[model samples]
Target: MEQFEAFLAAHLPSAASFHPHYETSLHQMLLGGGKRFRPALLLGVVQAYNTLLVPSAYHAALAIELLHTYSLIHDDLPAMDNADLRRGMPTLHKMYNEVSAILAGDALNTYAFEVLSNAPFSDKVIVKLVRSLAHNGGVEGMVLGQAIDCHFENQRLELEQVKMLHIHKTGKLIAASLQMGAYIVGRDDLAQQLYDFGIDLGLLFQIQDDILDVTQDETQAGKTTNNDEAKNSFVTLLGYERAMDEANALAEKVTRQMMSFDENLQRELSPTLTQYINRHKD
Candidate 1:
């Protein structure tokens, strides 16, 4: 874990040059940290197929993590979710101020693509990486999902609507992580299965998050909890029991897909994935 954290820190942009404060704001937010789940997932997918880790693999993983961090930073803004905490610390906006947080998010979001484009990989692989990321993180995916969330905030949503929202906001990036890994390794068959697997895994993750919001502590979650009651969420639409049931079922179903892969891969990835699903922030 320390090695991985160091690996990412080494690749992350330095808080230097023209806008000193903007760079500092982004560094603080990105460096403040979370589970680094997306990057680890990307590495996991790569490991499942390749015997050796390529240098580009780490770069690709860092890019996804940067994008994820960008979303979290902005999500905590007053204009967005108005979150006060993130990763168990005062939010970027709260620590740095609103303008810095917004600029930091924007910088990280764009810098993610820059990292992807500049990664030390073949042109073909680079193209695939950029295309896969843009499709998943762009208007049709995460962005669209966030739009739905903002539009439907504080309103009761149908079950399908809630599912769609989570899929776009969380699932797309998870799926993209898998896809990016496959692109890096030049593997297509496993990529397709892993992509599908990631979608189910992501859905389970979001449901678990909703469950945590109701059942977990804000301190443990490192962010606001119980926001689902005031926003469009699966728990609000499906109720606690049913939402939990769905999360369990999805985890089981996705884990079953592991049969298509080796026992070793399944054995290593399944427990971590399940732990994430079953987690209670409290």
Candidate 2:
């Protein structure tokens, strides 16, 4: 966690620079706090590939974080999820106003590329990272998921459609982060395996989130609870028990995939995966 903190600090824009006010609110919103799950996932992938090159892993990890932060900022906007609290703090829009939130999200989105360009790796690795981030973070991935989510809100959606929504909105970026770590270590096979693992892991994460929203407290969830029934969500279509069963099955599959790796990597990720699955707002 200290390493993750250092990575965030290293990539954060300094306050001493001009235009600080413009960037300040959004930066503070980001720095306020979250679980930092994405960066840790990237780091885990790197560790699995090989324990060397921790600094490169940190850079890639930071890039994933930036992209994630961007998504959160935009997701909280009035036109989107209209979220008020995020990660237990006032959202970017609530803290800095909608325009500032939009700009902040835009800045973070672009900065992710900048961070990738600055990574202490070969140009080949940098290019691969850039391409993967763009593909996963752009229209083909998160953006498409958001579009689908908005389009289906207040409308009934099939289970497959809901799964597709999560795959685009959440799974793609998770897979990309793991793949980036693999690229850094030159392990294509591990990258592919990790990518597949991430897809299942991400879907499980989303379903668990849906479960929490229905069963947990807003404070623990860091946002509004029971919003899924209002918006199109897997829980709405599949019901709570079925969603739980699916999430558990998916988690088991993810754990099985992790087990295929050496014991060390599986052990490292076990706590991470368990915490996510069992997290509660009670």
By lDDT, who's the top model here? Answer: 2
TM-score of every model?
0.93, 0.94
Worst 10 residues of 1 by lDDT: 273-282
Give per-residue CA lDDT, model 2, range 224-245, as digits (tens): 6766666777678888888778
lDDT of each: 0.80, 0.80
lDDT of 1 by residue, 1-282 (tens): 466678777877766678647667777767787877777777776776674764558878888888988888888889888988888888888887898888888888888988888888889889888887888887888888988999888788888888899899999999999888877877876777878888887888888888888887888778888766678877788888888788778867876776666875675466457557557333
